[model samples]
Target: MSDFTREPFPDRIFEDLGGAFSMGCIGGFVTNFFKGMKYSSTKMEMLSSGMLFARRAAPSLGTSFALWGGTFSCFDCLMAKLRGKEDHWNAIFSGTATGGLLAIRGGLKTSLKSAMVGGILLTIIESVSIGINRKTIQTPRQQFKEYQRFVQMSENQDKKSRSELKLSEFK
Candidate 1:
């Protein structure tokens, strides 16, 4: 059986919804933190202001989450059906569509700009994550050997520096 066939649809929808909600909340928090810092005089004031902004931003954030979740889920599902499997390119196209739709309230120009930026950012993030994950799967013994090599190199450099200092003293 295919991987998608093994997983039920409702579960996938729920997972996407949860991820979208979390991303929206985090984005709101970070945006408000900077806004608060710009307006508030002290650290305490910034904290208080950010919290207040977040409270006020909750409804809009929730709406954003719903929209993004629905759009991404639909597009991803469509892409999966077309390609017979999901991949990073599917994610990039879906993310770009989501971004553009999310900005539809602003205007066509804004939608295009948001789509381009969001697509680029998503591609970069996905590429970096893939690269990191690929490099992080070494065995414990391999990691230890790499660390030892690094230490040995550093020690050799230190000894060379010490020998140079000793030779300078004789001048």
Candidate 2:
């Protein structure tokens, strides 16, 4: 619910799945352009180095972009539908986790063909998995609820102790 915190799994999955194919396609184009750029390294040694670097860096970069893009896009969609936080940035923040997960999963194994496939799958699968996990795990709302409960309990105990002290003084 809060920025960059885990959201409900169902929300993640639905949002990711809903836009995975289209967004993944778009992501794929950006990814491919970079991939081509890497491949065009002039020196053979540089090309190899670039390839290695790309192999390592592409996944991280792509995933980050996807995560941010997907999270925001999905968040935007959710906002539009729910009439909540229609602010542009909040929507973008919302889909970050899902998009990042998709990028990591998809980008890790990127080739021109594979990137496309991976991007598509990442969008669909990662969103669903993130959604489910968010539900099971310590989401922001859940964490806040737990924190509130702890505070309330601590306060109650303090009050009870004060009451007991007053009673003992009277006795």
Winning candidate number (lDDT):
1
- lDDT of candidate 2 over 19-134, digit per residue (tens): 55446555555565567566674755555554455556555555555555555556556665575543333433344434444456556543244435544565665567668876
List per-prediction Cα lDDT, in the order shown: 0.79, 0.58
TM-scores for candidates 1 onward, in order: 0.58, 0.29
Q: Model 1 misses residue 167 by how many Å?
A: 56
Clashes of each: 0, 9
Q: Candidate 2: deviation at residue 32, Å?
A: 12
lDDT of 1 by residue, 85-114 (tens): 767787788888888988989999999999
The 10-residue segment of model 2 with minimum total lDDT is 85-94
* Off by more than 4 A, model 2: 1-44, 84-171
Report clash pairs, candidate 1: none
Deviation in Å, model 1, residue 32 alpha carbon? 5.0
